[model samples]
Target: MKNYFLEISFLLFLLTFSSLKAQTYARNGMVVSDNKLASDAGVQILKRGGNAIDATVATAFALAVTHPAAGNIGGGGFLVYLPENGQATTIDFREKAPLASSPTMFLDENGKLVPGSNHDSIKAIGVPGTVAGMFLAHKKYGKLPWSDLLSPAIQLAKTGFPLTWALYNEGNYHYTNNSTEFLKNYFIKDDGSMTSFGEVWKQPELAKTLEWIAKKGQDGFYKGKIASQIDAFMKANGGLITTQDLAKYQAVERAPIHGTFNGYDIYSMPPPSSGGVTMTAMLNFIEQANAEEIPFNSTAYTHLMIEAMRRGYADRAEYLGDPDFNLEMPLNLLTSKDHAIARFKNFDKNKASVSDSTSFGHPYDGENTTHFSVVDREGNAVSVTYTLEQSYGSGLGDPELGFIFNNEMGDFNAVPGETKSNGQIGTDPNLIAPEKRMLSSMNPTIVAKDGQPVLVMGSPGGRTIINTVFQAVLNTILYDMPVDESIEAMKIHHQWLPDVTYYERNKMSPDTVRALEAMGHEMIPVGQLGRLMGIQFFPKDGVYFGASDSSSPDGAAVGY
Candidate 1:
């Protein structure tokens, strides 16, 4: 048994090292994404006379088949697009609460929260928007046929693809605990064994679904046989969705939040996604603090950035939410230079701010998600982030559909306005309502210089996503590092709740950690922080640089 364990350990090490050996480089057109197969699919689109938007559509569909844990059609996400000569815009396809859903749906007879009921059940599923989102984007900016864009993914799903060791291990780790019966049925064989690495994995059902959608577009998924399957499943399992809910779902077109930091113009998803507002606020605070004066990754710089992030998160919890539901968000105040200066003035360089001491207006507040970036030679760029909310969300995937649904319903505050056992407010701007979209932290962003895109980036770590993207932007603009080093740098996150600061283990030096501790931070070390996908373009030189987080084994930055 000891020798067997040793052999497995050695093989895993070799696999990790081999994956790491693939390095970052520059190219003319590129796609950087969490899954290598998805990146290849996007590159193939670019090679076949497709533009950036076309490539992004292809990549997203391919990810649905290759990285099923997070990439999903049953889930929803945000997309930020920048055309060479056109204005930037965002597509909001975030999952919405069913019309029948109420604020108290997750509560019990006692009006108290029922812990696991919100996450691991059929009722947790929200009406998905990925198909609508993809179709709309393609309609507006796609240079290739919709059928052509989906062909790669359909082929990969129908024909078998080799399972990597990382995927095999992740499947076993997530499913073998008997946490979800459906997940076990999908990954585990009847012979009492789990699927092994290098096995040929096929999803013919998913292929058929994609083919139907390819022919009929969004209507195919939302109003046809696919919708019937979802409705049937919900009816049999005490779920809230109806055929009406699926048919009523529409992808919204929102104006991207615009900001300027260090001579670069930034565009990201607007409200309903607090990420853009919060991240922009942090950048404003950092710029106000003259953060460029400090050495990159130094203890002083880290301390300052952490403080800014702390305040940004606080603001997010207190004020940001779905604009349609809560129309009174402090948009002008939160993103203003004056507000940022005022917020930074409260920070004490030598000490961390206590959670209780923070005030409102004054203020405010992880699982499975994926991000991808693409850039075409025409200078069009796309940065997108999507998710299932958690690994195998709801664990209630339709076996016939060959896709997993999102437990985004769990994202809502079940007991709004109530104080938690941990001493934090339950909800305000993000309270649940019928058919309202939950607040999300997925920030797909693009940075431009005088109307020319310079950086396209985003990440997946639930709440930690905003901070990861914030730090990476700082590394590139303030520290003058390439995209690779910017993504690979150590990260620290403070969400202004529970009063605990979490830092990635070994990413920070011991002395830096000790200094932060001395400053009154209740620091906790974590193994990893986020998985970011980014591409940096130099319009003057016509060069493109791609970066994928090394922490994710399947991630790759492919270019041509």
Candidate 2:
């Protein structure tokens, strides 16, 4: 009788586990982002019959309220949108250098790059494009009312949201870090103490700004009172942006870069985002190498990947930049399979590729960034990576407006041909210039299998964004891991100039690190390479599975 009872209990446990696993399916819609409130806001839009674009707009705005460190309204980013029945496209609202900026803006009198000068000053601010970008995207594809999409964020700001441990940590860091300014203004109390976790944090001023935008549309922020306020602020703070710059800002719509890898089509943002071109080059190089024979995450496979990354980044430094400025960017040749093969031919699998030694054919010549993905019931999808370039960006807050502006100026080549501390040579194509967009690594990507959207993914880690997306795609396609497991897996990054292979601390075994080092690779164990968010679709099963990287402690993947 005891044995019979034990068998029945075991059977019940198995059934319960199976039922829980089956619940991963989402036939209606999915929203995966690095913040729970933001994901819930997007999901709310989907529940209200909003399309993917609407949900994305809603999510982006909500992120500004919930994840202020990177998700921002004062910054700029790129987006890739896939309609239910049309070709995928990208929107480039990347921040442009101020009209008053010059090529040597960040250089000192001695012609040396000033340490932290570009990042910690008001001059670091660019002519912001987040408002313009979202407005244009919504005007083109959003299904819900524009005001409706922004209401959630406005309401949250007016009322308040509980501070999560992640936010609390950010506030604590600002209190201690002398470089931080705006964060203290918003998160610190009158008594000079930081807001603790779970405390209600409100942004009445930000709410006012959102309310103005909701009522007046694009002109509300870009042309009227807001623009005048920004101009005044800039003049007072030594920033170069003017009311004319704000009024003239426009988000450009561009074709998404489409490439094929392992029988799957990958769609990503194009320049002034270097992400698409870089990711395409890496994928093509891997394809040319016949990398399928190697096991995923093994030492051999990791080495091959590092070499591929090195080659891609080398090409990036030499060729890529703002297409509007550098008309000679070799987009076709860069993305061509033939070019990839030619580039990979010189790679030696036995040893590390020296950054300065390899000579490539003359061709072209390309921070903190945030990403989120949304897929609605009608099969429409949107993947966006936006940012203010650093944690709390520029550290210069708009006191009256209550938000921080991006320090994207830090991304440009302060001086052409300057060698950075990391040993990478700055290229002329990306040199600072008036009205030129700074180069970016924000890659918002989508994967479709057999003409059906299967994966919507992207990440935030500046240069690490490309490789993180590459590994995640391979995780789902090659390893066939579940979406959650795939995002949870360890990630490693190598930018040719850095010459150091950074592996996620505690994720790679000591044996793997030793093996990589034995191959003449400099192995540096780092914490949390990138915070990725993804939604994987199983067409046959009529379900969607979403995953948020555990590194983002408060991230959420909501579906219905």
Candidate 3:
């Protein structure tokens, strides 16, 4: 009887412990996302003792499989890393212009802006850099072998994964207007109904490509059979990308743009991407506002931030561009404390500032993008942001290769006007040039405390990237909120274009909206705010916490 009772007690204890563990947060780490599997992959890597960069590489590959509509292997981006040694680095692997590109490519015979075709094979391409960038990051900081890190994505792609409601909606929205053969094969049913959530989606070709990459590293894509295949596809489809473009593609490692925000060292990507400079300038301006004392979401706080956004965006439009080409751009505009303070003097508390009135000549064009953040047990951090320029990326995909190309050429401004005070001509330095990279707005940032990394943050939304990062940093460091709440809170964006204040509905306070309206501001309800991802470290416990954007269907943070 005694033996039987002990056995029963042991069984009961085991059951109770299992239940408690299930109810509790994942202590090995947490990965929150719209797509649970993608998050799970990251958590798995962390559990296996891979560093943050390795986990990030795994998560990115998983995203490419499960969240194909947004996450992609054919795209390029920026990666910001803050190692435990206190060295911050940024890898600028953004897409590059094709060798055939020209500054006037987007202009018509009459010198007017041409209407861009969303499906022109010739215009749908850029030199992709994601593979190179990921490989470089892994080589530098990854704990796991490249093959092991890629296994999850390969399995998911080959065996298939279930689609979420968000993927269904986005796929339907993107493919609804025109049913191309490619769309029919991948996304649509015979009756033209979009594939619904819970349906299994597979990409055998992507799986094969991933397998090749795993075996051969970046060489498999850039100079091997994959490059040959891409060259053939582009040539046959009237695209300008050539094998030379692929063979010559390189991911440049650059020094991170650094700034001090309330004593925390902020690091982000530099030129060819305006995110770093613009973000630094905005934060510098806000630092002077003494924002810590203001109530969270108060009218005063919102007004000050909105005004500062206006100033920062104005600078982004007039003074920022591809540094290799734009030699006249006032680099001092962001680094000089005096210039940042001088710009702040123009902010008016009671009125919206007109962008053109405040800044010098020539407005520039922009593009859309995506961002993700990762942190590991060893304190290595990575914030990566990439894009295809626009939704569906010119709506052209190579069926054989199973990937769409980026339409980054449209990012350049078509019309050039008078020179600005910063010394640039009516021509945008970002104007398309042969083999020149288009200017991007992707900002991947890492924040350090006392020379050690404490936060890794970034966002995706064209001109809004800077503003989103600015707000999230303030929310996390100054407002003192957890990562999840800081990202979930309502957000506002003012890009100094059309001079309108765009706010996410039901996110910001009602009083804040009213205050902006009273200040002669035009308010528009935006369906969604920018997506942000961040990780915060707790020095006392030596544990790191991460959060993805609540607005994203697949934003997740996984730690171990």
lDDT against the true structure, per candidate, is 0.84, 0.84, 0.73
Q: Give per-residue CA lDDT, model 1, range 64-109, as digits (tens).
A: 9999888889999999999998999999999999988888888899
Candidate 1, position 362, lDDT: 17
Number of the candidate with higher lDDT, 2 or 3: 2
Worst 10 residues of 1 by lDDT: 357-366
| lDDT by residue (tens digit), candidate 3, 1-560 | 37998899999999965432222123344443334577788778888888778877887778777766556778788889888786888887877788887766666787655665312445646788888988988887688999998999899988877777777777776666564556545665446566678887677778998999999999988987889998888888788888899888888888888888888888988888878887788888888888898888888888888888777776777777676677777766565678778987877766766656334432332344667777665566778887766655655667767766676666665445534443233446666777777777788888888877777787777666777888888888889887767776778888766667888888777777887898878788887777777777777777667676656655555555
Clashing pairs in 2: 316-366, 318-365, 319-364, 319-365, 320-365, 367-462
Model 2 has an lDDT value of 0.84
Instruction: Tell me the lDDT of candidate 1.
Output: 0.84
Alpha-carbon shift of residue 493 in model 2 (angstroms): 0.8
TM-score of each: 0.94, 0.93, 0.88
Most accurate candidate by TM-score: 1
TM-score, ranked from best to worst: 1, 2, 3
